[model samples]
Target: MQKIAIIDYNMGNLHSVERAVSHAAAGNATVAITSDPDMILKADRVVFPGQGAARDCMRELETRGMAEVVREVIQTKPFLGICMGMQVLMQHSEENGGIECLGLYEGNVRYFGTVHQDIGVRLKIPQMGWNQVWQQMEHPLWKGIPDGARFYFVHSYYVEPQTPDLIAGSTEYGISYASAIARDNVFAIQAHPEKSADDGLKLLGNFVAWQP
Candidate 1:
């Protein structure tokens, strides 16, 4: 049986993610919500999900010594990062007054400040609703999910990957930005698939079946 570990560092909505993954797996895999580094490393797949402040999240991972474990796992397995999980993968963040991040990917996370569309209409920060995602490239996680599917988003910050090729998907709040990024075995999203309804479930299901 496949083992999927949802890393629990007290920074994310762990139970909700657990439930979503369970539902998506549908008796095909064993899912565990754990903070233990060994268990996370042992799993066939790893999911890093989080919400809240980036500084607090980084501190928790360091405090629990899961940082190295996460670094190792992402290199070895089919890994998925959600929201803050994706932000932390970048080299730095403009959040928390500019903090350093995991540096796994060449990018920076920036706060969405005073967004204005082409028509000069102001959009709210923390984009707390469904937004359309345009697939930038073909990826396994995009399997069965439509080209312009809407996903649930609840964040004031977004990732800016150094290379355009790393972007798997893009979305516009006031401007277009990388909503999803993937390279090798790692795929991360700035939105919450757990809360994205049908399209989200399809993404999670794709991840469960991904060989990657």
Candidate 2:
């Protein structure tokens, strides 16, 4: 049984994610939904999930003494970030007056802006519900998942990775954004895998069996 720590940053859906991992790992996995640094460092695998503004999430992480802990996890262990969790890995974000982030990845978060706003097509800014993701490349993190599988997404901001090959999959929302990424020990996703049904479970299962 893998010790998967589902980080409780107070900004993401934590419980369901833990459950999904438990099912995927097929073992007596432990899920700790806490901001405690010690618990995070002790875990075999760390999962960072988010569902809010990037700036606020960073603020909470810093306040909870998780900033340094997360930095260490990504530096030394297999780490996964989701949604705003992925955005926080970048050098900075333009979410609220341009705040600095964890600097794990060399890129900035950007919005859809007026590209779709003025066209009157009115594609939802948050990009909610299920969407198919085309596999940009092969990644061990996506072992059992097929190419162009549908996953659930709900976010207004998206990642534009400087290392494009780090991107494992992409989803279209007027424009394409990196929906899944894998860079050495670090893995991230813009979609909520825990909510994507069987496909999501398979993705989690792959992550559980993946090697850093």
For candidate 2, the TM-score is 0.93
Highest TM-score: give the candidate number: 1
Clashes of 2: 0
Against the hidden reference, what TM-scores do the models get? 0.96, 0.93
Model 1 root-mean-square deviation: 1.7
- Best candidate (score: lDDT): 1
Give the alpha carbon lDDT tens digit for every residue of 71-178 in model 1: 999999999999999999999998889889999999899877734533476768879999999999999999989998999999999999999999999998778999
Name the Cα RMSD for model 2: 1.8
